[model samples]
Target: MQKTFKLLLVILTYFSASSCDDLFEYHPNQIRLDSDERNLTATNLERLQKQQPGDTLRLIVMGDTQRFYDDAVDFVKSANSRFQDIDFVIHQGDISDFGMTQEHKWVQDILKDLKWPYLTVVGNHDLLANGSKVYQQMYGPLNYSFTYGHTKFVMVDTNGREYSFNGKVPDINWLAKELAPQQGEVWQQAIVVSHVPPYDADFDRKLEASYHHALAQSNMVSLSLFGHIHNWNTDYLYDNKILYHGTTTVKNRGFTYLKVWEGGYDIRRIAY
Candidate 1:
C-alpha cells in the first residue's frame, strides 16, 4: 500500500508540473515560439497555393479576436463544421488585446484548429509598443497580397492612429501598385482587407482621398474589408460601386462569408 501511494503521488506531481509549463509563460512580451509557429501567414499561404484551384473563391473574413479565446474556439468549430467548402480564412487583426505576444499566441493556438488555411492583417492594437515586432515575427509582412482562383487579396496595414496620423499608415503608393494588374497576374478582381476602413477616424485623414483614388484606378477592386470597431457596418463609403465591410469582433460571435467570381461577389454574415 505504501509503495502504491508513493507511485500515485509521483504520477500526479509529474502531470501537474507538465501541465503548468504552458500556463505560466516566461514573459508576456516574450518572443518565444516553436519553428512551426513562426511566419504563420506564409505557412497558411503555402498550404492555400497547393490546394486544387476552383472557379469561385469562397472564404471567411473576420477579425478583432483580441482576448476572446472561447469565442475564437467556437468560431473555428462552427466554421469547420458548417463551411466545409470554404477555401481559406481571414483574420482582420487585433490578435492580442494588450499587444502581448502571449495573447497573439493564445489566439493563434485557437485559430490553428481551423480546417482551412488562414491569414491575418495588422490592427491598431497590434501596432502598440513592441506588438508590431511580435506580430511580424509570428505572421509575415504587414502589407502583402496573395492570389487564388479569380481574385487577388490585398492584405494591407491601415492602422493610422497607431502611427499618430502620420499620413503614411495606409501606404497609398503600395496600395495603388498592389491593386493594379501585373503583366502576368491572372486575377480578375481585387479585394482589400485591413484593420481600419478609410472612413474611420483611426485612418489617416490626409491619405483618404489618395487611398480611394488607388482603388478607383484599379477598376478591378470588388470590395474592401475591415475590422477594428468591434461592430458590423457596411455601405458604399465614397462610390456607390465600392462596398466596404466592417466585421465585428469574434467576441461578438459572428463572421462574414465571401464568395467571388470573375466580375461579381457575394457577402454573407454568419453567427455561431
Candidate 2:
C-alpha cells in the first residue's frame, strides 16, 4: 500500500509541475518562439502564391485577437467551417494584447488552424515593448502589398499614436508609391488594410487629409479595411467613392467576408 501511495504522489507532483510551466511564463516580453513560428508572413504568402487565381477573390478579414485565446480558437473553427472558398485571411492587427511574444504565439497557434493562408497588419498594441522586433521576426514588413488576380492588397502600418505622432507613420510616401499604377499590369482594384483608419483619433492628424486624399485620388483603390475600434462600422468619411470598413474584434465573435471580382466586390459581416 505504501508503494502505491508513493507512486501516486510522484504522478501528482509531475502533473503539478507541468501545469505550473504552462500557467506561468518567465517574462511576458520574451521573444522565445519555435522555428515553425518564425517568418509566418513570407511562409503564408508562398502558400498563397501557389494557389491558382480565380475569377473572383474571396477573403476573410478579422482582427484584434488580443488576449482572447479561447475566442480565437472558436473563431478558427467557425471560419474553417464556413469559408471553404476563401483564398486567404487577413488579420487587421492587435494580434496580442500587451504586445507580448507569447500572446502573439497563442493567437498564431489558433490562426494557423485556419483552412486558408493568413496574413497580419501591425497594430498599436503589436508595437508595444519588444513586439516591434518580434512582429518583424514573426511576420514580415509592417507595410507590404501583394497582387492576386485583379486586386492589389496593401497592408500598411497606421498606428500614429504608438509612434507618438512622429509624422512618419502610415508612411504616406510609401503608400503613394504602393498605390501608383504598375506599368503593364492591368490591376482593377486596390484595397488598403491597416490597424487604424485615417479618420480615427489614433491616426496622425497631420497625415489624415493626405491619407484620405491619396485613397480618394487613387483610381484603383476600391476599399480600405481597419480594426481597432472593436466594433463594426462602414462609412464614406470623405464622401467620395472610397469605402472604409472597420471590423469588430474576435473577442466580439465577428468577422467580415469579402468577395471581389474584376470591377466590384461585396462585403458581409459574420458573427460566430
Candidate 3:
C-alpha cells in the first residue's frame, strides 16, 4: 500500500511538471498584434541602419501579419532557418488588427527574437484612422528606395488613400523617374514593392490604369511585387517584366522567398 501511494505521487508530480512546461511554452506562433502599434523598436532601427549596398540580399516578404501574428512568427522562424544569410525582412503591410498601440507592441515583441533586419510597408488595415502616423513613427519612411548588390529595391506607399477613392493612388511620376536607368548604374535588376497593387480593386480605376501604364514603360523594372490579395501569384503584366503578389502571413498562408542570381530571380513558397 505504501509503495503504490509513493508511485502515484511520483506520477502526479511528473504530469504536473509537464503541464507547467506546456503552459509556459506560449509559442504564440498564431497570435498577431493590433494595428496602431506597428512602430519600430530600438533594435529594429539599429538593424535597418546597418544595411549597406552591394551585399547579397536574402529577404522574406510577408503579407497581412496582423490577425495571424503567431502564424507570422512561425513563418519567420522557418524562414530564419532556411535563409541563414538573409540581410533583412520586408512585411508587405497589415501588421496589426486595428492599428492600435497594443497590436504594434505585440508584433514588435514577436519580431524581437528574429536575428535579421526587418521592415514593413503600410497596408490598408494598418491605416485605420491614425495608423499611418503610428507606422511612420515605428518604421521611418512610408515610400523609399534602397540598393543592394546588383538590385534597386523600391518600397512605395500604395495605401496612402486606402480609406477613400482618390486620384493620388501611387505617385506614378515618382515611380517612373525612380525606375529610369541611370548612367553607369551597377544595379542590373530593379524591383518595386508595394502594399497594394495598381490593379487591386481597392484603388480607383483611373488611378490603377495610370499607374499600370507607367510601370509598363519602365524597362529597368525586373519585378513588381504587391500584397493585399492574401495569396501567391506570378502575374506577367508586360513581355519582359513580371508582377508577383505574394500570400499573407495569416491563415498559415506561408511566405515568399526570392533568390536573385547573376542570371535571373526565382521565387519559392514556404509553408510555416
Candidate 4:
C-alpha cells in the first residue's frame, strides 16, 4: 500500500508540471517568446536587404491565418514548392484568431519553416484582449517601412474601427511623410500595406476621403496592398488614382502574387 501511494503521487506531480508548461499564463497581457521569434519584422527585413533585390521585387502576399493551423501548414508547403522563384513573403494579418500570444507563437512556428523571409501587418482579430500588446512584442511596431529594390514598402495599421474610430488611425500625416522622399531614403515608388482597406466599412469612414487624397497627393504612390476582405481583389479606386490589391485569407488556401518593378507592377492570384 505504501509503495503504491508513492507511485501515484509521482504520476500526479509529473502531469501537473506538464500541464503548467503547456497552458500556464501569468497574465492576460503577458508576452512569452523565444529570441528568434521576437522582432521578426526587423529580422526578416535584414535578410531581405542582404539578398539585394533587383529592379523588380517578387512577393507572395497572404493573410488571415487566424485559427487555421492546418491550412497554414499547407500554405508553407505550397509556398515552398516554388521556393527559389520567390523573393520574400508578406502576411497581411490575423496571425491569431483569438488574439492570444500562444496562438501567435504557433503561427510563427509554422511560418518559420518557410524558405524565404516574411513580414506581417496587424489584423482586427489580433486586437482582441491583449493581442495588440502581444503582437507588438512579437513583431515590432504596428506601422513600419522598409526600402527594397526600387520601391519603399510602407506598412500601416488601418484597423480604425477597432480603435473606435479614434480619428488617428491610418495616420494620414505619417503616411504623407513616409510617402515623400527623405535625405537618406532611396526609392522611386511607394507601396502601402495594411490589413483593412479604406473602402471597407470597418475602416474609418471619416478618413476615407483624406486617405484617398493622401495616396493621390503622392503621385509616385500607386499600389496599396490589403488582406482583411478574405477574397483576392484588385481595383483602380480613388477615382482611378491608386491601384489596390486585396488578398485572400489562409483558410481559403489562396494568395496573391505580386511582381513590382521601377515603373509598373503585375498581380496574379494563387489558389494553393
Q: TM-score each candidate.
A: 0.91, 0.91, 0.76, 0.93
lDDT of 3 at 236: 73
- For candidate 3, lDDT tens digit of each residue in 1-272? 99999999998898887745334434322222333333353345465657663344566777787777777677767776777777677778888878764576667767766778677777888778677776777666777776666777777778745747766757778888778878977777678888877767775666776676666677666677788878776677544456655555555657877766544677877776
Per-candidate Cα lDDT values, in order, are 0.88, 0.90, 0.69, 0.89
TM-score of 1: 0.91
Lowest summed lDDT across 10 adjacent residues in model 1 is found at 19-28
lDDT leader:
2
Q: How far is 250's C-alpha from truth in model 3 (Å)?
A: 3.5
User: For residues 43-126, what per-residue lDDT tens digits would candidate 2 score against the true structure?
Assistant: 999999999879999999999999888988999999999778999999999999898898888888899899999999999999
Error of 2 at 15 (Å): 12
Candidate 1: tens digits of C-alpha lDDT, residues 192-265: 99898898898999988888888878898868899998989988989887889898899999999988888888
Candidate 2, residue 61: CA error in Å?
0.8
Clashing pairs in 4: none
> Which candidate number has the best TM-score?
4
Q: What lDDT score is found at residue 241 in candidate 4?
A: 71
lDDT of 2 at 44: 92
Q: Which ten contiguous residues of candidate 2 have the minimum total lDDT? A: 16-25
